[model samples]
Target chain A: MRDVYVIGAGTTRFGELWERSFRDIGIEAGIKAINDSGITGNDIDALYIGNMSAGAFINQEHVGALIADYVGLAGSLHIPATRVEAAGASGALAFKEAYLSISSGMYDIVVVGGAEKMTDIGDEMANYITSMAIDQEWETVFGATYASLQAMMARAHMERYGTTREQLGMVSVINHRHGALNPDAQFQREIKLETVLKSGYVAEPLRVFDMAPLSDGAAALVLASGDVARKYTDRPVKVKAIGQASDTISLHDRREICTMDSTVYAAKRAYDMAGMGPEDIDVAEVYDSSTIAEIMAIEDLGFFPKGEGGKAVEDEKIALGGEIPINTSGGLKARGHPVGATGVAQIVEIVKQLRGDADRRQVKDAKIGLAHAVGGSGATAVVSILEAEI
Target chain B: MNMPRFWREKQGRYNLVGNRCTNCGTYYFPKRDICPKCHRKSIGKMEEVRFKGTGKVVSWTIVHDAHPDYKDMRPYIMAIIELEEGPRLTGQIVDCSLDEIHTGMRVRDTFRKLSEDGKDGVIFYGYKFRPVKE
Candidate 1:
């Protein structure tokens, strides 16, 4: 296989963007990435679009063609536009497909992106769309919302690991602090641990502050073979490893609620493929759909021992200027999780950090970075490791 | 309205038993036609097993917001109770305040009607748990 590198990355400010249509948001990010890569539309060999719920959210489908056509890539005869849907990991799965296409010499350059138009729908509708990842047969029938599922995991973790409400609160605070520095983050203001703790309960143990808001946004990346990458940019973030895993879809089916075995499996595979462990990375972006999810990812990624993830946050081990700064982009918690876009957005953050362009949230001399994206109640997981050099 | 095939099974007195392949030992709740572990379609019969519904609270959250059908059910405690059978089940925790529910607290199952198939239809009865009496 040939080496694959990220030549350019772009993402819109994540939030309830009511004015931006899904096509516009996707095209905006796509155009920005193409421009940043200093490549014309003609240089792109194929396109992959990750969208979770356009059909359910906007009553629209064929989003890959919509995005490509909106960007004027389809005017001229073009390659097929592959639409990837793996719940929230939809974006990462798209990126993985594009990355492999280039690495396998099937394509010299590929455009991989994800977009979600969430705010147009009411919160109720949005929640339903997001709930599509859960087991329709067993879990959803019982009125199990994603928040409820996370709540279940949170309670389990609390019991097994002694993860406290305060520690979970710390995750929101730390991410918001970093998000305060992120211009494109949905939430730009810093939140105190106290505020998170005092927030009204959305689910027991988890407050309103614990969950990510309904967001509408898009993120795009340009991937090219190592040879093509050198021509497009001076600093290309190497795609060292990518791994995806799945557990039982129904939360009830899983043997353990607190243990995200899929994420742990994916992370271990990524680390093994990269020939390094989580400690070898200078920075990380974990799926912080909720403060609890971030803590779970931190532990699953091996940044901390099992059950100590919450303690890692409480001890300031995951904060900026700490032992390992996690989610410098504010993460999904503070950054706003536009479901489909979150995974690609995480990659954009990692690429920016590896390229030393993150400005305020930049991890110093960050040579390697990791991104983990989880789909629906820890059912599907994807882990990618990026390095500065081959 | 007719229940979904999965929910239809719950109406039986089987207690919604899950089957485990004795050979590979991969377990499936609500039972499975084939073993996920060994891929043997000739799976063992699902044994009628009942959980004390008594299990430790693995995790829980009180949902202040709920789907419209459950607007009345807002602020209800939805929790996962890890059964001794090794499957973690999702259910509402009744008969307890939000503060009273904690991870690792023992819970007992109460078979209850979770929702109506609508007003004039089948009442969907499922298992929810309450804090086990000390």
Candidate 2:
């Protein structure tokens, strides 16, 4: 297989973008990435769109064609657009498809777009739709909300490992600290530990602040074979390795309740393929749909031991200036989780860091970066390692 | 869920019926055609078994914010229960207050209304856990 590189990355500011339509943000991000790569629409070989529950969220389907047509690639250009869905991991999975297609010589260049408009619906409806990612028959039918599932994991982790309320709250605090510097972050102000701790409970032991908001946004990436990438951008980021894994959809089915086995397996494959361990990573972006989720991710990614994630957060080990500097874009917690767009947006943050474009949240002199995305509790995980051309 | 879908799962929903792999001796809730551990070896070796519905809470949450369909049931306790038969599943723990519920608390499944299609629609009944006082 040939090498694949992310030539350009672009994203819409994540938040409750009530004024923007779904197609509008999609085309905006896609066109920005295309323009950044110095590539014309004719250079794109195919389009891949990542979305979760657009049919349920907006009562719209056929998203791949929808965005491709609006971007003017489906009609005259006649682009073959395929929509990919994997709950929250949709974007990274779509990126994996594009990466593999280019590496396998099936396509020389591909544009991957991830978009979700969640604010169009009410919070209760959105919660129900997001819960569809879990086992509907056994879990949701019995009245389990999305936060409740994560709350169970948090409860288990606390009982098993002594993870404290303060530690979990710190994850939100640190991410919000980073988000304060991120212009695109939904919550641009830092929050105190008590603010997270005392917020009204959504699920016991997990307050409203613990959960990521239902956000609306889009992110796009331009991927090209290594041979062709240099012609477009001099600072292309190499797709060093990509790993994806799946676990049982139900939380109870997992062997370890606190750990996301999918992340453990996926991160292993990514480190092996990249020939770089967690210590080699200069910066990283991980799914923090909840503060507990971030704590579990860092441990599962091998940045810390299994039970020490809470400690890692409390000690400021995940802060922008701290060791490894997790979630420089504020993560889903503060960055806003527009599920479909989150995975790609993580990569966009890394692209900026590697290219010295991130103004306030840049991980200084960063080279290698890792992005982790999780879907349906811990069922689906995709880990990708990117490296600067330098 | 639609009528036919709920209708098809009546046995499991009502009786805590699950399938067991004869080869691995592992049981699956919500039923499974293939045993992941045994893979091809356990194919066609699966048998339906009924659980005693007695288990301890592995992990749990008290939900203050509920889904639209479950607004009437706010501040409810949901848990991951590890059945005596060895498989775990999600269920609601009723007939108890939040402070009384603890991890590893012994419980038994009780038949109750899981949900409904509407006020006058199909009232779906399923197994929910209640604390075993003894």
Candidate 3:
């Protein structure tokens, strides 16, 4: 397999983009990525989009064709556009496909993007639709919401490791501080631990502040073969390795509730492929749809020992400018989790840090970065390792 | 949300019916054609088993925000119960307040109305758990 490198990345401000339509945000991000890559739309060879529930959210399907046509790559260009979905990890799966396309010599230049228009539907309906990612018959049929599932994990983590509510609150406080520095983040104000503790409960043990808000946004990346990467940009971030894995869709089926086995498996494979350990990573972007999810991710990714992730956060080890800076883009917590766009957005943040472009939240002299994305209750996980070319 | 789809699961929903894998001696809630652990080895050898519905709560949450279908059911308690047969299932823990529910509390399955599609539409009924009375 040939090596793949990301030449450009772009993302729209994440929030309740009520005025923008699904295709509109998708096109905007795509165009920005193309422009950033110093290439024209005509230079793109293929397109892959990651969208979780466009059909249910907006009453539209065939989004691959819709995005391709809306982006002016139809007819003569005939770009083979594909749509990939794995719940929240849709964006990372799309990026993985684009990387494979370039690495397998199937395509030299590929545009990978992820978008979600969540606010188009009301929150109640959106909640119901999002639950479709899990076992609809068994899980959702019994009235299980996503927050409830994550809450269950939080409860288990607390009981097993004696994780405190304050430790979980610390994750939110730190992420909001980083989000305050991010101009494109949805929630740009720093929050305190007291704010999280006082927030009304959405699910017990998980307050409104502990959960990621429903967001609508898009993120895109331009990937090229390593040999041709220099033509687009002088600074290219190499995709050193990528790993994807799946677990039982239902949380009840998992062998252990506190630990997400898929994340552990994917990270192990990714680390092996990259010939680097978790300690070697200079910066990391993890899926923190909920605060407890972040703690579990840190442990599952090997960044912290099991059951000690909460303590690590309290010690300020994972904060920006700390030992191992994480979620410098505010993570899904404060950065906004646009479901489909989150994974790609994570990559965009990493690329910015690797290029030394993240002014306030940059990890000093960052060379290697890791991005982790998970779907459902750890049903699917994707881990990618990237290194700065210079 | 087809009627047949809901009707097909009536057995598992109404009764605590599941399947046990003879090869691995593991039980699965909602039954299974093949055991996840034993795979093909347990295929065709799976036995329909009925759970006693007695179990302990493994974890739980008080959900204040939920799907529109359960709008009236907000602030409900959902729990993962480890059944006496060793299979775990998610069910609403009724007849108990958020303050009363705790992990390791003994509970028993009870049938309850889940939700209705509309006034004249089908009213779905499923199994829920309630704390075992001393």
Candidate 1 local lDDT, A165-219, one digit each (tens): 9999988989999999999999999877789888887767778899888899999
Give per-residue CA lDDT, model 3, range A13-125, as digits (tens): 99998889998999999988888899887789899999999999999999998999999998668888999999999999999999999999989999999999999888888
Q: What is the DockQ of candidate 1?
A: 0.57
Q: Give lDDT for model 1.
A: 0.84
Give the poorly placed runs of model 1, Cα more than 4 Å off.
Answer: B1-17, B20-27, B41-58, B82-86, B95-111, B117-123, B130-134
Q: A278-374 in candidate 2: lDDT tens per residue?
A: 9999999999988899999999999999999999998999999899899999899888999899889999999999998999888899999999999
The Cα local distance difference test for each model comes to: 0.84, 0.93, 0.93
Name model 3 segments beyond 4 Å from true.
none
**Weakest lDDT window of 10 consecutive positions for candidate 3 chain B:** B66-75
Residue A102 accuracy (lDDT) in model 1: 86
Sort all candidates by lDDT, best to worst: 2, 3, 1
Winner on DockQ between 1 and 2 is 2
Q: For residues B39-72, what per-residue lDDT tens digits would candidate 1 score against the true structure?
A: 6554554444445456877667778767655667
Each candidate's clash count: 8, 0, 0
Candidate 2: docking tier: high
